[model samples]
Target chain A: MTAPAGQRGRGRPRDPRTDQAILAAALELFTEHGHAGTSIEQIARRAGVGKLTVYRRWGSKDELIAAAVESARGEIPSPGIGDLDGMSYAQISQVIAEALPGSARTLAEPGYRAMLAQVFGSSVTHPGLMAAFWNDHILPRRRTAHLALSRAVDEGVLPPETDIEALIDMTVGAVVYRLLRPEPPDADELLAYLRSVYEQAGMIPRR
Target chain B: MTAPAGQRGRGRPRDPRTDQAILAAALELFTEHGHAGTSIEQIARRAGVGKLTVYRRWGSKDELIAAAVESARGEIPSPGIGDLDGMSYAQISQVIAEALPGSARTLAEPGYRAMLAQVFGSSVTHPGLMAAFWNDHILPRRRTAHLALSRAVDEGVLPPETDIEALIDMTVGAVVYRLLRPEPPDADELLAYLRSVYEQAGMIPRR
Candidate 1:
């Protein structure tokens, strides 16, 4: 409750301290008990903030979830168009190897799984979460992959008639399948395998 | 409570019907509110049985959850070698076509998603579930696909050195990726794409 002089206001101010604490608490509980098992009261208690404070800040459980997700998880940014334009297969696999672990760990969490289940668990009722992930992350990546495939064509690497969407689907889709495998291949192995498969498909220059 | 005629020998033991009722009620509640959201009192009232009955049958919420999943949402049976053998690509696709929809729909349910989130949400902790699915269902299918591919190779349909596992991963994986997609592709289109991809890999006999 120290009133930092620079940010002091006339009314009772919102606390950044409480917000960080809440996000941390939510991550812990979501990791431990799963998103479905966690409750607002539990998060508030873990954060050392009042229940009213949490509710006042985030409103509903879903909103709180969204806020926590915004803080705790971020997607891989779309590769810059220039980066995509000149990217070699080695460069592409490198980006994948770099980002795959955190993506693996986060997706490996029960909290994230529960969120996926909610988005996908009931296609009739809870499709929004899964849909947003595609629009936000999955689809954009495919688009980038497609443009890269076109560049590969221009570079005389792959056959011009190769289905870019299918090619991209096979590459990214394999990454996902590996992630969900019982003994998921390590990030390095996954990247190597991806490189191998894409190379076989003639997306990479033959050494 | 209907007293069993044979139970009179033991001073009329507690009604098995009551026990059944309580189990059913608990299952219903768990499916509605998830593992953590449900309460003993609510289960008892729904079952028209005593709270003590639930406590006696299963000591803790986790135990009750185990019972419900075991009894009601039990394991799915694998498609046998017979189905996978000597089938056209369409028939192969049809097997997945019929089976995946139900699994996909069930995955979409909130409470079910919650359960999965609890189990598979943190996939690192319980690799067992994912393993079970592969061992029980996917591995057998892979073997069948191998048989088909072997036949294709024998018939000079496919390249001799082709890695069958990677191909299987790509073919089957595409369907799985689509199922998990935010905007799940139409089933008919999905099957067509799956067949086309398999044909491209020379898994099926080409004219």
Candidate 2:
């Protein structure tokens, strides 16, 4: 209920570009210092904005983190027709080949580790953080794998009684567990072998 | 080595009590602040010891952190059953129920998550941390589960044709994935259901 007209205050207006910039900076901060260690002042400084601007835009550090992570998604390769699901398990080995090089580098980066620590660690203490990390990252990737498996199941490549949930968890979870290893098994080779097992268990002829 | 050893160079000799106090302080600090956030000054202050005293004894923060964790290694549980050849799946489920509460909580802790991030993340870069983490933590816990499954197979409780590793992994791995959730399921209930599914797969009998 503003009686005064044209009372808006600002220089160059509120650019969504600036918001995106701030979010990007926040992601960088989280990746560097983690959620607990990061501060609004750092995000603002990195974004070339004022601390007041950060506080005004996002009420708390948690909100800022959510916004930052929400952007910069689509970086992860979704499990779809491309290399993961489109081809037969044997053919899908190529996708793993493509990913390993980057996986090696990305996992090595301190920023990446810090980011993972911030998310996986804080998830237990903060439900909101857990929701953000899962919905934003895990669900999309999980859906991709789920779709691939669903296709495999529909094709009768898996036994009608195949434990779909178990099958998915074994392959995916094992990969994550192995990611903690120095020398992980080749994803494609493992996938190729796993698919063979899946087919054999289902009584399907393996190529 | 003919030296003037008149008074051993300083005021109070190194007290075992002080050493224990320092270690305890380090543990409390590490648990509260995580590995990366904790510092030597904080540890010394918490212990009510001089900074020089702590530095002289522990040497480095990493060394101190390692000592603090190693001291608590005795607390991690293990299924004491030497062989499970005669035990039913209920026996196996019982073992999990007894051991999993602490296991779940350990994996859920922020400090442990920080440690995990350091190991897993550095594994891509340093390679040594991976071997250490596996040899120290993951492999040992995993061995108990593996031994139980293998024994079940040997005793004819489980089908001989079972992919023992895969089956065991899939079952426990799913539970672990669920355990990492903010609102974790009841460990007993989950283990019971997993055993039932194993029975359906003929890995274990219905009874």
Candidate 3:
């Protein structure tokens, strides 16, 4: 239970900022050093907070790391599945175009690449991390992509029998494959590649 | 620099069997516990050999892991670019069809998935490992895929303006994506999905 302002101990006051700082530090540490490499003490040290402060919020390291990764959802783009519900093909394309610059920038970052690698690597051994990632980060984007594909089918751009899941896998997988390469693409290259994949899939019209 | 068998000490003779054992152990350790978690001592212990045996063969952990990863080149399927050269589109498709079963089986294995995750995760942090994997494993396969795509262009299966690299990325990426999912597809499903992506890409004729 969170103590009222008056009932708090003599420790530094806890606020939304403290939670943000702890989560950010956790994400950075987890990205740099994998799940096993990072520890709660390290997170607190990096966050300039007491170990108890982190412990107070999260019951375990997995929980903390899960929260840290979930925090990254805002940094990456999602399809805005609900908003896209009734959008036309052109409208969907516009949303994707506007989002590409930011998505490309984030995906191109070395830190983000490492973070994704860590997450994927942990899937078998550390199921909790992968579960959190899948639920929060992956599912929404996947849903959005599915909706867009459905729209494409309805609009007669893709044949009704088009394997939408396969298309999503290819589009997402291609981006990941590019990122994991020894020489990953830069933002501009990544943007061009994303546009090309979407255009090829008929999700967006070619220029 | 080899001591003749007659000149060898009481220790076990350095032989191909020993090398295989060490490499197998190194790969197993690296897959189970990532690059950072594995150690030479553990590898030796796992292989039932002396620590010096591993050191005598590989100068460092990175070299050992590199060799270990390189040793796996035979396990995964790659396009035989030379064989595919000048072959008809139907011939190319036959080669792919024959290869897909083995590829699907390997890709569906949990151990293979974990190994891939480790290799990809280490790309930025451990370039040496990725370099060896690329040179020994990835490069040949990529070359084969490229040749196949070029053949598709020649056969008029794909448009002349087709982005072969993008198509290749999607196919490989889709397989990898499927493997890393929480509920990864079984061999049969993986085979079907692979066929779908290839068929969609015009790399192989749809049945």
Candidate 4:
């Protein structure tokens, strides 16, 4: 094998492509077979890489899963702080309204829901996976949501004494609960459902 | 082994204690190891019953899990319609307030959360389990919730145009989402959290 320049190690240089392949494999196997059910050997085999190749990058299965989850951070709609900053109330409202359809579509995806199920299901057994998801994915979105709610209060859209955390919890929790139910709504129904929840939470004005 | 009095073309008569033992074993195994990871032999061994006893009661794994889930219904709070039917608005409010502490304690239990996680985690892989949960557990609570919200609207506790279904979704979802978080609140914090959510939703007045 021709060695690429800039490689100081004894083996091949770290390739982004291989990293992606390995992470993807880890996510798929974990999603399908769960945390305990999957192993480094299975992931390496699935990625078509040597076990040493996986071990070199990730010392343990948990570490690899945490990285995979971190990489999959924003599969659901999470409007970042950058996206909301400096936008007028009307502009912010319009952006969220426009985003709802696509967000609903994503929520309706089987793969995404399965991934969430796996994270939750494994939370008690493998706390690291949930911890990774919370730190990397949920915390950022929560901060952005806090910013958005603070802006709403400042703009006099919501009552001054509004419980921002509770509102956010209800809104997000409602959507997730709806998704996890048997015969979850299709994309169109989910869009409508999301709108209703927002309206109920007073996040969006009633239509 | 002596056959009991109700034997009709059967080796041994049905025993309530045997049923309880088998169901308990099934629930425990499923909660710990999940659906695909557990089997009849394991459940039988745990319950100290013959595998044939399990087969005689539930023809398949899915059926056993379904029955176990059905038996475990109402592990969480679900104030029934009958509980609310004759109560004054004030009485209903007091009952709910009194129930909140116990409900919070149940919600904060690790066993309950672990059971919930297993159900959700197995949802994609085992739709039957979720279906049984929905029909046996969630639907009755939904009906009761609808009645309670309706009573509130009728008694002028909520606005006339309140969307009952959306409100219920948000309330139930918020609690579930809170519980599923990495660092779930303790009983006291969960009690406060529940109060905050209800207050925010106008289900209960601000303290």
Top-scoring candidate (DockQ): 4
Candidate 3 lDDT score at position A63: 90
List where candidate 3 sits over 4 angstroms from the true fold.
Answer: A1-14, B1-14
Error of 1 at B158 (Å): 5.0
Instruction: Give the per-residue lDDT of model 4 (tens digit) for B37-120.
Output: 899899999999987777877778898988987777766666777878877666666666677888899878887777778888
Model 2 accuracy (lDDT, Cα): 0.58
Candidate 2 lDDT, B24-78, residue by residue in tens? 8887776555566788889999999877787777656766766765554555565
Residues A39-99, candidate 4: write the lDDT tens digits. Answer: 9899999999987788777767899999987877666676777888998766676667777
How accurate locally is residue A98 in candidate 3, as Cα lDDT from 0 to 100?
78
Recovered fraction of real interface contacts per model: 0.28, 0.26, 0.57, 0.80
Q: Give TM per candidate.
A: 0.61, 0.65, 0.89, 0.90
What TM value does chain B of candidate 3 have? 0.89
Reference-based TM-score, model 3: 0.89
- Tens-place lDDT digits, model 3, residues A1-207: 343233434455669898999999999999988898999899999999988788777767899999998998788876677888789877887787778888999989888888888887787778788889889987888887887788889898777767888888888888887888777789999999888887776667778
Name the lDDT value of residue B161 in candidate 1: 58
lDDT tens digits, residues B41-72, model 1? 89889888766666666665555555655544
Alpha carbon lDDT of residue A54, candidate 4? Answer: 82
lDDT of 3: 0.82
Q: DockQ values for all predictions?
A: 0.24, 0.24, 0.56, 0.67
Arranged by DockQ with the best first, the candidates are 4, 3, 1, 2
Residue-level lDDT tens digits of model 3 in B9-59: 435466999999999999999999999999989999999998777777877
The candidate 1 chain B region of ten consecutive residues with least summed lDDT is B1-10
Instruction: At residue B88, give the lDDT of candidate 3.
Output: 85
